[model samples]
Target: MNKFILIAAVFLLTGCPGPMDPVPQEYPAQARLVDNKVCITVPARAGDKIFSVQFGTESGREIYKTFGQPDQQLPVVQGQCLPTFDFQFKPGERYAAYYKLTNPHTGPGKLFAARFSLEKSENGHLQLKQYSRSEY
Candidate 1:
């Protein structure tokens, strides 16, 4: 009886996940064209930082440059995450934006990439359109 109880206890404990397990972190971001520049916006969280931003053509032929700072920073909420980064890039053409987000508390970072394009409206205005985005 004692041996069976001990085996059952071990199996139950090992089979179930603990409440202290760390949850996977997700970093969501968006991109658009503002005044002929690509503006990348990312939600900010405590201890989370944008490591790098790389811009290139949709074909991935040429990479322009890598940036580390955002052109604008919004206010950080106390307990809520808000869009706090605005990285602007003057591509002057269709391009893709790639970024990496990291957190010290987490083990590794996540990679996010997005492609965008611009179209002229009937009113003779440039409009920004995002093709697709992927997270890895």
Candidate 2:
């Protein structure tokens, strides 16, 4: 009886393994500006929807921002899912694009701090110039 009481007391003190350690957060998708367009890709088929897209240019060209959520997943090209946001860019300038994943199943629906940039090509068209993801 004493042993049973001691074991019960220990179990009470420790507390049942901490509520399953919280469901691991999942990130939905990522994007990059390629060929004057936003190219996005998800780790799984479920995270194909892009909730919001915002852009900034070196010239501060009017600050473009828009929201899009396709009823179905966009077509995959080169294994990367592309969103429908138009990439109207200012020529001969550098710009950054920010993205956020919307679908709940995908991890936290937060805007990734990574910025995708575009630069004017020699031919005077916006092309994928750089990509940066935030460590924080």
Candidate 3:
């Protein structure tokens, strides 16, 4: 009886194993400016989906200051899964694009931001250049 009690005490002290931490998943994306619009492309990943996108000239910190809300909230089509999405924007200007992605069975979601600018190419054509991207 004492041996059984000692074994029980050891087991309690060691503690039972708990659930392991989930591995972080990556959702790669790309953005570009075409004509007078900004195009964002996110390849389809297993169990990952983009639900919302926001565009603005402010930084991610500034946008988050406004409770993670931006002036231009792009519409996301429901029930339609597309790799590329385009929205109207002014050329020759710098802007930031925020994306909200989620795994249906996972927790809430994840937020990502990309900053880009337009520059004149050698051929006098406007070109889009992405500066930085962050996941939050």
Candidate 4:
């Protein structure tokens, strides 16, 4: 009886996880064209930090010079690291830009979206859509 009561007390002390609790899933890197900039969403473990985001050609040529400077440390809200920046490219022009998101401890994570383009809506507003992201 004492063992059963102790177990019950332990369970009560540690509350159960509610629906709002964050779950650990396959959190891959993502990208989207917002306004005149390309925004990338990179997710890491709770305590992990994203050092920098680098853009390169499809052939793996570094091209960070073409894009605007990124924020030193992107804001990680709701378990997502959002890093956004502008580039000097035409809207409809197809460019093979590959993104490399780096972490000091975890090496580097990559994402590539082919023919990256952002289209205008009928309302004349730029809409952000989920591009097909293949994690590398």
Candidate 5:
């Protein structure tokens, strides 16, 4: 027991390495209006996981915040999942969505931020949200 304790203490005394440049409270994501649903598809790496996602108003109001972050369980899954958020928007107006990605195994991962705009059709139907990945 004493030897085990000693080894544990030594490990703790050493510095711990943490993930660098983690995603902030918010991210930069975009969505496009398609068939009455807003969709944003980001390619996933092997073993990658989705930590959190949200749809916020241009004024900073969060309409959708998923607590149980989604994860990609299959290691061989090579493509991205199209996470769609159904929304009602006005044409000629814009909105933003945010998403976070991580490595569930390591708890350390990279973040991708993106944005998009909504285009109003002639019939007043809102469609197409577009944006670029940048600092959230």
Candidate 6:
């Protein structure tokens, strides 16, 4: 009975996870146009000191840049470590958002999503969808 009581005490102190606790997932990389800027969300840390994020267009044209923390990067917070910037593009104009994360010790990370487009749509008199990424 002592073992059972000890187990019960441990379980009671630790508590249990709620239904809403989300588990983390991983992906390669991607980008989307939101509002006035194209944001790229990459779940990675700087392999070394000075992580550099280079962005470009579908035709391999330069778009934006971002520099991450030095050394081994800290655990990324929700919605953190994202590179966002503005580029002049016409409506309905297709764009390719590519990024390369670079550090001193490691080479650039691979990029995907080369067929993204900047689009604007009106849902109602005041309801307009700008950004594509939505957090639940």
Query: Which one wins by lDDT: 1 or 2?
Result: 1
- Best candidate, TM-score: 5
Residue ranges of candidate 3 with Cα displaced over 4 Å: 1-28, 33-37, 58-86, 122-124, 133-136
Superior by lDDT: candidate 3 or candidate 4: 3
Error of 3 at 125 (Å): 2.5
* Better model by TM-score: candidate 2 vs candidate 4: 2
Better of 1 and 2 by TM-score: 1
Which window of ten consecutive residues has the lowest lDDT sum in model 6?
127-136
Residues 1-136 of candidate 2 have per-residue lDDT tens digits of 9999999999889875667766434343455555556565555345435556556665675344445545532323335645536656544555555555565565555453334455667787666544443411
Pairs of residues clashing in candidate 5: 28-113, 28-114, 29-114, 33-128, 91-120, 115-131, 116-130, 116-131, 117-129, 117-130
Residue-level error in angstroms, candidate 3, position 42: 3.1
> What tens-digit string does per-residue lDDT give for candidate 3 at 64-87?
222233333333343333333444
Cα lDDT of model 5 by residue, 1-136, tens digit: 9999999898679755447644355433435545755656555566765565556656554555444534432222333334534545444555665556666666665454456566767896766746554522
TM-score against native, each model? 0.49, 0.46, 0.47, 0.40, 0.53, 0.39
Counting clashing residue pairs in each candidate, in order, gives 0, 1, 0, 0, 10, 1
lDDT of 1 by residue, 1-136 (tens): 9999999899788875667665544444566655554556665556665565466664454543433454432333333432313433333457666666656677576665666766667787767777644521
Per residue, candidate 6 scores C-alpha lDDT tens digits across 1-136 of 9999999899779875556664333234445444555555565554522233444444556755544545443233334435334455444554544444444545544343333555555742211123222310
Q: Rate the local accuracy (lDDT) of all candidates.
A: 0.55, 0.53, 0.56, 0.46, 0.55, 0.46
Rank all candidate structures by their TM-score, best first, as comma-separated numbers.
5, 1, 3, 2, 4, 6
For candidate 5, the per-residue lDDT at 100 reads 61
Stretches of model 1 off by over 4 angstroms after superposition: 1-28, 34-36, 59-92, 133-136
Output the worst ten-in-a-row residue range by lDDT, candidate 5. Answer: 72-81
Worst 10 residues of 4 by lDDT: 61-70
Misplaced by over 4 Å in model 2 are: 1-45, 62-78, 113-127, 131-136
